[model samples]
Target: MPTLEPSAPPSTQAAEKASRALTIERLQEQAALARSIADRLPWQLAHFDLDLRCRFGNQAFCDGLRIDPSALEGRPFQDCFPQDALPALLPRFMQALGGEKQLRLTEQSTPGGAHTFTETSFTPDVHDGVVRGVFVETKEVAGRARVDDLAQNKRRFDLMADALQDSCIYFLDPVGRITEWSESAHRLHGFSREQVGNMHLADMAAPRVGEEAEIGIDDTIRLAIDRGQWETRGWLKRAGAEAFWGQTLITALRGDNGELEGLSCITRDMTAMKDLDRVMNDLNAELDRRVTQRVRQHTVPNKDLDIFTHSITHDLRGPVRHINTFAGLIAEELGENASEEIRHFRDAMKRASQRLNAMIENLLTYSRIGRIDLHPERLAMTNVLEGVVSRLRQAAPDRQIQWEIQPDLPMVVADAAMVNDLFTRLLDNAMKFTRKVEPAEIQIGCRTESDGTCLFFIVDNGAGFDVAKASNLFLMFQRQHHSLDFEGYGAGLALCQRIVQRHNGRIWLDSTPGHGCAVYFTLPVETAMAASGLAALGC
Candidate 1:
C-alpha cells in the first residue's frame, strides 16, 4: 500500500478514540434498555442525584401514588412522599450514595388516601469510580396482606369433595354435631342444611345392638378420636325414612400439635347394594325351599303359587291370543258375506280377548311391583307430573281435557319410577271418567300441612261414584264404573295403593255419587319429619 506509509506504532491516540466511541455507543444502548424496561416492567422506577432531587420517575412510580410524573420530575425527594416518611427513608438513600452498592427499605404511607405499604430498593449509580446518584425501584404491597388462611383451606377441602358422586361429604365438630353440609349430603341424607342444626351422627345412624363393636354414636366418636380414623358399614336412617345400609368414614382432623380440630365424615350411600342383597336373599330362600321340598317329596307353597300364576298368565295367554287372532282373521274373511249376528259374535270374541289380555298384563304389573326393589329419591313433582301429562296426551290426543296443574309443588321422597307410574294411572283415569263431561276438567296439586307433610290431590269434574264404593277403589279386579262405559282393567288404583304403601305413604279417595271425585295421597317431606299423618288417611 503506498505501502501503508510506516504504520505508526499502534497509535495510543487512536486507541483512546476507539474507547470513547465504544463508551458512547454503550451509553446509547443502556439508555434504550432503560426506556424499554420502564414500560415493560411491573415495578415502578426512579432516579435521584446526589443532591437528593428526583431527576427521573417512570409513569408507574408516579401513578401508584396518584402523583403526576411531570410535576414530580426534578423535584426534591420529599415531594414524592410524606414529610414524616422522608426522615426514615433518608438514611437508606444516604447509605446507597455513600458507597453502598444496594439498599432495601420498607415503609408505610397513606397513598391515594388509603393506608398502603411500599417496598423500595436503592442502587448506587457509579460513574468514574464515584457514586453519582441512587436508582430506586418501588412496589406497593397492598394493605397489610390480609389473608384468610382458614377460609382458603376450607375452600380447598370442598373443591376436593365436589368431584364425588353417590357420596356425601360433611364436617362434624369435635363433639359429633353437624357443622358443614354439601349438596351430596342433602341428596343422600334427605336433610337440608337448615334442618341439620345440632343434629349428631347418632341422629341419622340406625341403632345397632349385639353386633361387632356393639358400638353406638359415642363409640363411633371415641374410635375416630382415639384411633385418628374409623370406617364402618351399617344401616343408617334419616328423615323418618327406612334404614338403608351405608359405608361411612370418619377421620379426625388434627392440628399441628396432634390435637383434634374437628372431624371429617364421608358417607357413601349403599342402599342399592343393600336392596340387591335383599333380592339375593329372597332368591336364595326360594331356591332352598324348592330344593328341600323336592328332597322330601313335598311341594313348596311358593313354588305351587308360582306355577298357578304362570298357568294363569302364560298358559292362558296362548288360548286368548289365538282366539283374538282367529276372530280378527274371521272378521277379515267374512267381509260383507257374513250375517249381522255372525259379525256381532266375532266382535264380542275380539273384545273379550282384548279385555282378558289387559287383565293379565295388569296382574303381571301388579305382581312386579311387589317383587321389584323400592329406591326412594328426592323428586321434582312438576317434572314428574309434566311427564305423566305428556304420556297421557300421547295416548289420547283427541280427548277434550283441561288440566289445571299447580306450580311450585313441594318435592317428595319416593321411588321416581313408581311415582311416574302412579301419576300416569291416576291422571289417565281422571281423563277417562270425564269423557262424558263437556270440557273435562282435572286439577292436580299439593297442599303442605303445618306439620310439613304433603297432601297431594287429583280432582276431576266427572261422573263421580258413591263414597261407599271408594272402599273398593284399591281392591284387585274391582271397578266402580261399568266396564261397558269406562274401559279399564281395574288394576290402576290398586297398583297405586301398593306403591304408596311401599313408600310408607297413604292413598285415599273423596267422592260423592254425583258431581266429582278427588283422590288424595300423603307423602313425607324429605328435609324434615312431621307427625305420621296415618290418622289423616282415615283408613
Candidate 2:
C-alpha cells in the first residue's frame, strides 16, 4: 500500500467539509422557505416550542390578535391570550403535542360588544422523530358565517316573493337604478330580469301627464331617501303599451353606518278594482236615467187607466142595472102571454151582463200585475205550473188542452204571482191558437248546459209567427196574430222579457211560419251565483 500524502489528506478533508456544509445549507434553505410560506399564509399561523413558548407567529396571527409579530416571538402562549380563553385552548394544544393527532376547535369572543367566531386547528410539528412543537392555523369564521346566514335569508325571501299573488316587490339603488325584482313584479310590469335590472324607475311611468302623475322620479327617490318612505296610487305603463292602475310604496334602505344605500319598492295592481268601480258608477247612472224615462212615459198612461177605471165602473153599473130591471119587467108583464122572442131577449141581456163583469175583472187583474212591486222567491216550478193549469181550467172551461210538464223542473227564482200571470198568458195563447187542432199540445222543460247553466223552454204546437217579425214580438201592445184569433192586450211577452232581464238572464224566440214556437231563456251557472247572489231573486 502506498503511504498517504499530507496534501492529499488536506484536500480530501476540504472536500468532505464542503459536502457537509452544502447539506447543512440546503436544510437551512428549506426551513427558511417553509417559514416564509407559513408567515404569508391567508389563515392565522403560529408555532410553539416544546417549552410551550411561541417561537414564531405569522402576520395574519399578529393582525388577528392586534399584536406586533416581532414582540410576540418567544412569548408564552398563555401570556399572549386572555386568561379566560386559555383553559379552553390549552386542551387542544396539549392533544396535538401528545401524539393524539391534530385537533380542531371552535371558539367565541365578544370584543367591544361585537361577537367574533373562530375555527382553530392544532397540528403537531415533529423533527427527527421527536415532538418539538405545535402548529396552529386559525380562521375567522364570523364573516363566513354571516355570509351563509345572508344566503339562507335571501333564499327564503325569494320563495316568499314568488308566492305572493297580489303585490310586486323590487329594489333600486339611491340613484334610481333597479337592483332586484320579484316574480310578481315581472308578471305585473311584463318585464323580465334582464330588462328590469339597471333600468331607471321613471321608465315605468305612463306617457300621459297630469297633476297626479309622477313628474321627476329621481327627485322622488331623493325625497324618499331623506324622508325614509313614500307612497302613491296611479296609472303605470305595461309592456304591451297598455296602462293599469297601481298602488306603489317605496322605502329607503340604510347601511350599518345609517347612510342611505338603496330603496325598496312594492307595487300592487288595482286595475280590476278600478274597473269594477267605474262599471258600478256607470250602472247606477244608467239605472237612474232609465227610471226617470220610465216614470215620464208611464205618468200619462197610469192617469188614463185610473180615469178609465172610474168611468167604466159608473157606466157599466148604470147599463147593467137598467137591463136587469127591464128584463124583470118584461118577464112579469107577459106571464103566460109572453112570446118566446121576449124570453130569449131577456136571457141574452143577462148573459151579456155576466160576460161584461168577467171582462172588467180580468182588466183589473192585468193592471195589478203590471203595477205591483215584484216580490221574488225561489219556487218549485212544478208547483207553479200546476197552479197555472188550475187557474186556466177555471178561466176557459170550454177549451180542451193537453199539458206536458217536465218532472222535477229546475226551481226558478221569480215572483209567484208574476210567474202565474206569465204561464196564464202563454197557455191562453196556446189554447186560442190550437182551438181548431182538437188536441192542443203544450210542452215545458229545462236543460242543463256544460257550463253548469240551466235553460228553460216553453214549446207549443200553436200558430207560430214568421222569423222576420220576431223583433216586434215582445213589444207592448204589438200583436202578431189577430185579436179575433187570439184575444190579448199583448203585454205578456214584454213583461216576460223585463222579468228575465231583471234576473240577469236573456230570453229569445225561435219560430217559423206554420210551425211550432219555442221560447227559450237562460240562467247563470252556480259558480256565478256568488257574484250575483240577488240574481236568484230576479233582481
Q: What is candidate 2's lDDT per residue for 1-539, written digit by digit as tens?
A: 99976566778999999999999999999988987887778888888988899888888888877988779888898886666556446655776787544333343536665444456778889889888999877876647678456556666887888777767898875567776667888888888876764577888877456525553676678778888988767778778758888878889988677856468998888889979998999999999999879986886787677567656755676777787788788788889787888789878888777656655555554444444555666767789888888888888898778889999877665666666766676666776667766578888888887765678888888778887966787775667888667766666677677656655667888887667688887654444344336433422
**Which residue pairs does candidate 2 place in steric collision?**
none
Give me the candidate number with maximum lDDT.
1
TM-score of each: 0.42, 0.43
Off-target runs (Cα >4 Å) in candidate 2 are 1-355, 386-403, 435-440, 448-455, 462-539
Best by TM-score: 2
Runs off by more than 4 Å, candidate 1: 1-311, 328-337, 397-400, 449-452, 528-539
Tens-digit lDDT track for model 1 on 1-539? 36556655578779988999999999999977886778576778888998889887777877765877668768888777666455445655766787664333343435564444456777899999988999988776543443233334545766777767878898776668776677778877788877875578888767556432246677888999999999877777667577667889999998677656568899988889878988999999999989777855543554456456756787778888999999989989999999999999998898889989988888777767765666666788999898889888999989978889999988777777888888888888898889999979999999887776788999999999998756777898898988889888788899999888766678999887668889998777775442243222211
Cα lDDT of model 2 overall?
Answer: 0.73
TM-score for candidate 1, residues paired by index: 0.42
User: How accurate locally is residue 19 in candidate 1, as Cα lDDT from 0 to 100?
Assistant: 100
